[model samples]
Target: MTTGNIKPTKEKKSRKSKPVVNEKSPLLPTKHEEDAAGFDEFNGASFSGAVFNLSTTIVGAGIMALPATMKVLGLIPGIALIIFTAFLTDASIELLLRFSRSSKSVSYGGLMGDTFGKYGRMLLQICVLVNNVGVLIVYMIIIGDVLSGTTSSGIHHPGVLEGWFGVHWWNGRTSILLITTLAVFAPLASLKRIDSLKFTSALSVALAVVFLVITVGITVFKLFSGTVLMPRLFPDVHDLASFFKLFTVVPVLVTAYICHYNVHSIDNELEDNTQIKAVVRTSLTLCSSVYVMTSLFGFLLFGDGTLDDVLSNFDSNLGIPFGSMLNDAVRISYAAHLMLVFPIVFYPLRLNLDGLLFPSARPLTSDNARFALLSTSLIGLIFLGANFIPSIWDAFQFTGATAAVCIGFIFPAAVTLRLVNLISNLICHQLSFCHLKESRFQFSLK
Candidate 1:
């Protein structure tokens, strides 16, 4: 029986043996299948590890600014905005995951590529680069502030480093940042996968909790002692400028919850990828509680005097129990937390850059030399940025308004909507084809 003379019934049997697209859920792929394709590395992270990593990413320098946001928007609105931003952030991440599953994309850049082609990928990469770099620079600035105190109006508040080294040139912001970047951040950033940073992420979260505890303790003590200043529930809105500037808090709050960039990266690390939504929800809820406590207590402690950086509100002159000791502890602990956070944010940045610069090269995670060079170059840029940028608030505002908004809000929504349209069209086409086949059969019978 030559193949050319095979019976039509046998040919039909062969066709029927092939896999049918409609038989499988379009968005859900089996774990073994994705693993065999090398799209994800299994057993990389546990549920707690993923949650810790994501919580650390979400609750960085942004929380320090939330008290200041309360000063601008007043207590009620600020708290409301924080909760609202968390909700929106959660929604956006859900969209990303939905689209990512449908497309089988392993990274944000890949998702964009799948949805909008090369230009879309490039756009997302650019946004990640800008947002992450700006954030890292802000981290450096806060670290510098804590380690080498800021001088305002000829009075010097001693930084932890400055206090230890007595105003020496080597103890300056530039020197401290350089030493820390080389000694600390570079090594952490060099880790290949985000899951490896789980231990450090846990430590960072602990330190953040410590900072929150100290703030809450101080606020409660001050309240009992009749020393705490109460913040207004609503802003006074004395002028048009002040009223309009109320909108500015939106971007800051948005930036506070800007962990959308790393959602897929963390998802890729999970041992059970099906747990991503649970991980996201848990992380966001934890971060929201932390933000609320930090902002509420921070605002209560400082009231309208809250600086753009809440850590700045702590001074040795506060005369609370262990006032000076608490100051150093809060600053050092939070700065250290930021140190751990730098690597988490950098993970996605490096991933996106690799996709842009070496699209055809092997995965950077698997390429030692390329990963080293990329990490070094990015840290160097951030190093220079930290040295020059005088204010983190400015950096946060610019990046938050542009890149953060696009990545956190616009891209996910657009991609998910596009996927919906594609699925709708496919269903419509399938139904039309089936109707036509039935019509032809009916006509033949007649």
Candidate 2:
């Protein structure tokens, strides 16, 4: 929960990470302290924390557009692509764990710095900053939709500081931003531990699951009831090229899968490294399964048509419920999710910025620091791009190429080589150092 100034080593500029527990610097925590923080209060996170980290990492606004992604890739290839992406991501995660074992550091940014250098750390900072902004834009759009729908439903929009000002004022956009700032960012900023929000994270995952199940049910119902109107649920050879194009869908999904950054915080709370791995594996598997099923069924039912939300995407011919009520439900649920997700992304943005620019500053202790950084970011987003939220898929493509692939693919390979070199030179003492030589071989193949 409390990071406790666990800084990554800065002495190594070579693309080779020095193991953290080497004899030169033997002050590293014992195996128990290395596994987790030794503080009584912040020793380990609950199962709820694991679920929260997993769910928050996995769920993105991308679920809304998965139908479109599937349409682009077609059926069989689309499924294959998703599976392949999952496997690739899993491998990267395992490599990250191996790197953690070698370096004895748990944070993703720290691991990256250990593996690469100052430049790599800066690159990760930029990636997290951009990704966080993208997420903010999404929440803005989602909040706007919710506000619009709520105002239209024979209810007045919530006014800001009405009691303080002794007057009523209503602006949908401003209201949403104010509420988001107060309800989401305020709590997130005050928190010292990322694991504290595990409950909300678990709730979000559950909600996503419910949404998926409802979508699959609707899809199956539509199919069986003979009201299904989409193209046949089958692949077309002509769509093969487009299937590769669908790789654009990987970034945000990868972002949604990014749990490494928070691993340090989680590890501090965990007693057993094996338990942590088990939890991580279970959470990722469950989240991915839900996402894949939801995407597949939504596409099967709706085909290429617009599926802003899975529930509302169904055709008009298949009567299910009151249109207005369902629309409101979908909008409200989405809005709630966006709000819950804001902190998860926002804190990382704050941490990365602080780490890169003002590594010594404590934004947590200073109100001025928090407001200056967060408000400036939010205002810039509102002024620059809140009105036209960029395409999620396009954003994902850019993020995948820059952040996901680099962090997931390149960093892991680098660390593995560094670890092999450390082990071979120190433990085995082989004159030829065949293992060290083979490290580069694996890196090249990767």
| Model 1 bad stretches (over 4 Å) | 1-42, 151-157, 434-446
Report the C-alpha lDDT of model 1 over 1-446, residue by residue, as the tens digit.
46987656521212123221110111111222422243432334688998999999998889888898888988898898889888999999988888776776656666777788778878888988999899989999888888888754455556887766687989888999999999999889877667789999999999999999988998898899998766899987999999998877776788889988777667665666778899999999999999999989999988977777777667566668788888888888999999999898887787777767876555555677888898889999999999988777788889999999999999998998888899999999999999999999999999
lDDT of 2 at 126: 76
Question: lDDT tens string, model 2, 237-348?
Answer: 3566855665655664565555555554454445344555667677667867876786788777667664443433432333554634443454456557766766665656
Q: What's the lDDT of the predicted structure labeled candidate 1?
A: 0.80
Clashes of each: 0, 4
Best by TM-score: 1
lDDT of 2: 0.57
Residue 319 miss distance in model 1 (angstroms): 2.6
- Stretches > 4 Å off in candidate 2: 1-41, 145-178, 230-247, 307-318, 362-384, 421-429, 432-446
Please report, as a residue range, the 10-residue window in candidate 1 with the lowest summed lDDT: 20-29
